[model samples]
Target: MTPTLILAIAGGVLIAAGIYLLLERSLMRILAGVMLAGNGVNLLFLVASGPAGLAPIVGEDPELIADPLPQAMVLTAIVISLATAALLLAMSYRSFQLEGHDEVADDVEDAIVRRRAEADLSSEAYVDTSTDPNDDSDSESGGRFDGGRVR
Candidate 1:
């Protein structure tokens, strides 16, 4: 296989693995996923830039010189990834200090909301008491808004 194709495949695999790791609740796993994805992106950028050539300096033929845009983009992505990794590390550290573990806990409110939705029950805050049979405004249309008010 061509070198470009091989690199592309490797990049794809790395991205896929990173996405899988990102689905986990562990912060460390997420950090690794981010790093993997970032490197994969950098690899893809290199592949997209085509084969390496002379540096894009003066006196070099423009056609023979490699594009610098992709390199610049990869650098920017690396910086962003680094920032994100640092943020996640800090968050995980704080979580460990407070909870003694880095595993993320499910939110109680989200579970309650999910249960309510599954049971087809509306929250008390949004319950409409008007029982006009002629008014079909509140039919099960998934919360349509009319005239700046929820129907």
Candidate 2:
């Protein structure tokens, strides 16, 4: 009972710390947060799996057999988390090598996009003067139908 309570409390703390780190702008902190979160999740899963019992094998009593699914899932999650953490660490190191900092920089492309969008919104209305005024097809059908066909 005491161990279970401790595990739950520790897991909660880990999750909270991970989230706090994740909110930081530093990429390295984000990587650490991810690792912490993964470990917290694994601990939570272990706590949720009830008391440990006999190994799950052929001829094992159903009442004494421990659930294998959660353990398997946690193992897989650990591997995936490790891989992602390594990838993130590599990316953070590369960024530091190139940019000299782990802080996320604002996107210049987004500013350009915003300026373009504002220009489009404030631009003059479009006027098409290339169409011949004598063209009766567009006038009669309102540009929806062409020569009696639904085009």
Candidate 3:
């Protein structure tokens, strides 16, 4: 197979594995997944940038020089990934220090919200109580309105 095809396959595999790991409840696994996905994306960017050629300099012919946009994008992606990884690591560390484990637990608030949603119950805040008989806006707008406009 061509080198580009090989790189593409490798990138795909990395991305797939990353996604799989990302689904785990462990914070460290999530961090690893993010890093893997970032590297995979970088690899994909390299593959998309076409074969390497002359350095993109002022005197170099545009056609003969490699595209710099993809390289710049990859660099930006790497920085973003690094920042995300650092944030995740910090969070994991804090969790470990506080809870003695890196595994994420289901949030109580989330569970409550899910139960409410499953029961098809709207919160008190969403229940509109317009006592004005002349106020047809709520009926027209399905109980949603913003500054006399339907939202």
Candidate 4:
């Protein structure tokens, strides 16, 4: 098979893996899928350079060298992948802390619902201490709650 065909087959495999990962409910898997998809696209870029181009950098005229465009694209892709992976990992950690699990109960829809619930909880000021009516406690008196509108 031609080099282009080989690249295409490899790219297709990566894309398929990415799609499969994306379908998972676990946030970690989803993020991984995104990364895989990005990599597949990067591969496609490399393959689509007409199978014969320059080395993208300052170099001697090497016969049949790949294009600079693909190399540039790959570098950008790497940076973007790193950034996206970092952000996704951060989000996964935050989700785990909030929900006590990595698998989100409602992968997509629950986000809005959970957010609204949190918003409501914050807005409701569950307590009504209202402050010390008889300012008896000294200003230096420390407590679990440092004086404020309980509700």
Candidate 5:
């Protein structure tokens, strides 16, 4: 019968739906889930402040009006949530661009296996990075720079 009770039920329903959508494979559904959860939390804020009443007065014994605190709090929370959502969207777009898909990356071992296959196919042995093997003269025995001094 009360607004608080109504909001409680709504919040519960929203939370349940959000959880369901979050489990879905689609990216858009995930975003929708996040948004629904945010709204559900906002409803909780309003529900905590009791039903609407007369606005507070500027007096020693102030009238018990519907608290403005929750409304202001919800506004700030909404802005923060939007900013976070935008950042998540940008990251998702970048991921899609790089991988050509929106799905989560496969297991780490799968990538490692591909890397191992490429390594096995390589024709040359490991590179000799410290010195050039082509230098066959004893005159260049000093070798590469060792601690900034020619070794």
Candidate 6:
């Protein structure tokens, strides 16, 4: 097959796999997915930049000069991707150190916020802490909140 067709197919596969991995809960998988997506983007840049040819030097044969901008942008993108991957790896390591596993965990505070928001969606006002002088959520939450509101 032509090189262009090959690159297109490879890029498509990489993007698909990257998306699949990104949807997973594993940090390692997410890192891999980001890398794959970066590679796919690089391949797309290659394809968009057109066929490689002789350098675009002045006074040379006026035929088939490759644009250098896309190549330069792709290189910059590669460096950025590498930096991002390294950062993600370091964060993943730190997370693994703190928690026994690298799986993404739900924040209890976020869950509580969601529950409260859902409760507020109903027209019936239940346990309005602002007016209720005897709210117990603050006492039950181990002093995590002050004046019946989360701190």
In order, the Cα lDDT scores of the candidates are 0.85, 0.82, 0.85, 0.76, 0.72, 0.81
**Which portions of model 5 miss their true places by more than 4 Å?**
1-3, 106-151
Cα RMSD (Å) between model 3 and the true structure?
A: 7.5
Q: Please say which candidate is ahead in TM-score: 3 or 6.
A: 3
Cα lDDT for residue 24, candidate 1: 92
lDDT-superior candidate, 3 or 4: 3
Give each model's clash number: 0, 0, 0, 1, 1, 0
Give the alpha carbon lDDT tens digit for every residue of 30-49 in model 6.
99999998899899899988
| Residue range 1-151, candidate 2, lDDT tens digits | 6999999999999999999999998999999999898899899999999999999999989999999988999999999998999899898989999999978876886675566576664333233446787877665346653222232
Model 1 over residues 1-151: C-alpha lDDT tens digits? 9989999999999999999999999999999988998899899999998999999899988899989999999999989998999999999999999999999999987887777678777754344546574676567466564322355
Off by over 4 Å in 4: 52-66, 107-151
TM values, all candidates: 0.77, 0.70, 0.73, 0.60, 0.61, 0.72
Residue-by-residue lDDT tens digits, candidate 5, 1-151:
9766887999988988888988876566777788888889888888887777767666534456667899999999899889878976886788788878665656776675566567673432233346555756523454453322333
* Clash count in backbone of candidate 3: 0
List runs of model 2 lying over 4 Å from the truth: 108-151
Which window of 10 residues has the lowest lDDT sum in candidate 2?
Answer: 142-151
Q: Return whichever of 1 and 6 wins on lDDT.
A: 1
**Model 1 whole-model lDDT (C-alpha atoms):** 0.85
Q: Point out the higher-scoring one by TM-score: 2 or 4.
A: 2
lDDT of 1 at 26: 91
lDDT of 5: 0.72
| Model 6 misplaced regions, further than 4 Å | 108-151
RMSD of each: 6.8, 9.0, 7.5, 9.1, 10.0, 5.5
lDDT of 1 at 79: 90
Cα lDDT of candidate 2 equals 0.82
Candidate 4 per-residue lDDT over residues 1-151, each given as its tens digit: 9878998989989999999999998999999899988888998988886766655466766675665767788999899899999998998999999988778575564564566476665533244356675665623234343222232
